[model samples]
Target: MYIITDQLKENGFSVNRLDQIIKRNNNKRQFNTLEYFCIYIIMENIGLIVENTSYNITAGNIVFLGPQKSIEFGKAKGQDTFIISFSSSFYERSIKDSLFLNSQLFFNYNSDIFIAPFSNIEEMRVVFMDRMENFRKKDKSLYLSAAHNAIERLILDAFLHIPTEEVKKDIKFDYLYCVNKFKVVLQRDYKTAKKVSHYAGELNVTPRKLTEMTEYVLGKSAKHVIIEKLISESKKMLSYTNYTISQIAFELGFSDEGNFTNFFKKHTQKNPSEMR
Candidate 1:
């Protein structure tokens, strides 16, 4: 469900009644969303298709989504969920905590985090219910502070529940810190920054070092990552928009239509037209 923008402006965040939202908007086979970081506490089975990955959500499950991450609902009925959504600005203003948000849970590339049946489930449920009641009361001072605290508590609980191995995994490849940051850089500038050296320069690493870190972390070289991102975007535009190949090519920073066609065919082994 989408965050109601007006409520967010007034309260720095918003909580959606998840069952109501699904009832109102679940007519479609897929509901693709591209806004807000979302946290879902599930009271029953709820399935989700996020990007290309599928998640089976069940009772006592907590699902976290990053901003601009696309997701579609999977078919399951009789589910009750509490969905908390907030903007990056609001979250920062309320808690001043980006560390956990940037950890494996929230904003990492190609990853989403979910927790199942934590020790503080009842505590979290109480906080969520209390926050909802206060929110319905429309007492700004009361609800806003409570809502912020409730969300912060949920985040802390999530951090506490994270597995020891996950922490060790992150520490093992300390270069992963650089790799994740490099991913952010690539995501922001992939269209214009085509060369590995360009991304390496932005991340203040040598091209070879960048490739090595990326391969170590992602199992692909830096150049493959950049090219794959471009190809993925191209596929999206080709499938979803009416833009011609030439238009898509120019829009994606290729010098010419022929160059774009060659790249697409080289990667996909099919012309863009054939794919479309």
Candidate 2:
């Protein structure tokens, strides 16, 4: 597994081999880091446990581990694998364009990694592995920026092939409706009210109804959904954009910047700049 404690390390990153820590399952051995992201291609035989999440990475598929994430994995069963790490800056200049976002072939809304099927992965991996090899070889002409861009393109191609999960027709309507509606209102006013009652009033529903609806749709309370979306959006802005604290607060519609800072600090422990 790869972990980056700092956003931009010298020559780009620092990685440590995590051997038996995960097999033992002790909670104390956590690898903490600053804002960063990593990608891994694992054989089906190997496995990983990230914090409380357990997953297996089959060949031709990609998995992502983001900053401040602690994880553990096993050795490969047969074929070789890959692990690439980079700062967010790598993404902005390479994969952050609107074309990449709309490329559908390499993007998804609900999940971080977009998995491609074997046929597509096979075709893509040839070109991808070539670039990977060039970076690994550390040729004198190779630059850190070029290496990051190649890896980013590979990630996007993998995502493009992953289709959105078909929403089950039999799923509960109360849940689906609430989640969609909540997203609509949330994007409009996440920073202003961010209270259950505020959203409930807009929907003309009672707080109890709002809670029940949210639980049905998202397995969470209305308040939790609001907090999660706001906090997540706040972090995305704080990390990806160069906006100042007050400008961010004002844009998000906070009455004042102090309220926004307090709200963010309450959830994340670190203030905005500290997060950066």
Candidate 3:
């Protein structure tokens, strides 16, 4: 395990071996809500649940996760795996890098989990090893920059191997940028601003234009995006917290418990209590 953090702890990065992480957690499967972007390299078969979806990952597989996602690990005894986690502030050196991070390559709102097989497992290992070496450096002068470069290399390598068709070529970068900004704003104001018009007002675009942008880039309506985010947050709270259904509703800015129940059941086909 190698952990490097800034003084404020807002910008930090870490690399840890799978076995060590499990051992540190009393050898139990771990459930985590990531606060940073993460890359998981699996050298053995494993099961993973990302935001309520299960995936079977085998050797040579890599998983990418954006921030605020819930992930549960399955057993992988004697398996070799490495987890690299870094905050956005730690990784973003320029506006281009920030936009790249928000791109579909990493933070795709349409997908819960992104997995791809490494074309060259040894080469991937070398990248992680280099990052670890940078963390081990004592001089500490160029370590942060070197680590950033290593992460950039890893992302670009993954981009190359990910199927070209998976990339959204039809959507221009401007639309993608607007859609990404909408997502960021949606995440920040989901509780208070549940309506599409509110988001459009915040983004300085008309509601119809927002919907057009979201549809162009994500193939989903802006309203659907907002509701999806609300549902996701609702599920997270129900699954991970002891809050009652009514409290959860209030927290999510619902007018009343009954309204929330109707909305939840309409979308999920289950009551909030049933989900809990």
Residues 1-276 of candidate 1: C-alpha lDDT, one tens digit per residue:
443457866655777656555665645434433445678787767777665456787777777766555566665553356778876566665223555555566654445445545555566566787657866698777787777677777777777766765553343234665676676666567778899999899888899999998887677999998988888889878887789999999989999999999999999999999977
**Which candidate has the top score in TM-score?**
3
TM-scores, each model vs. reference: 0.62, 0.43, 0.69
Q: In lDDT terms, which candidate is top?
A: 3
Sorted on TM-score, highest at the top, how do the candidates line up?
A: 3, 1, 2
Candidate 3 lDDT, 65-162, residue by residue in tens: 77666677887773478877887778877866765676655676657666767767777676676655656575454666666776786677677765
- List the candidate 3 regions with Cα displacement exceeding 4 Å: 1-11, 22-34, 94-96, 161-178, 181-193, 197-213, 229-276
**Each model's C-alpha lDDT?**
0.70, 0.57, 0.74
Report the alpha-carbon TM-score of model 1 versus the true structure: 0.62
- Residue pairs with backbone atoms closer than 3 Å in model 2 (clashes): 5-33, 5-34, 105-160, 106-159, 106-160, 175-217
Error of 3 at 275 (Å): 12
The best-first sequence of candidates by lDDT reads 3, 1, 2
Clash totals for all candidate models: 0, 6, 0
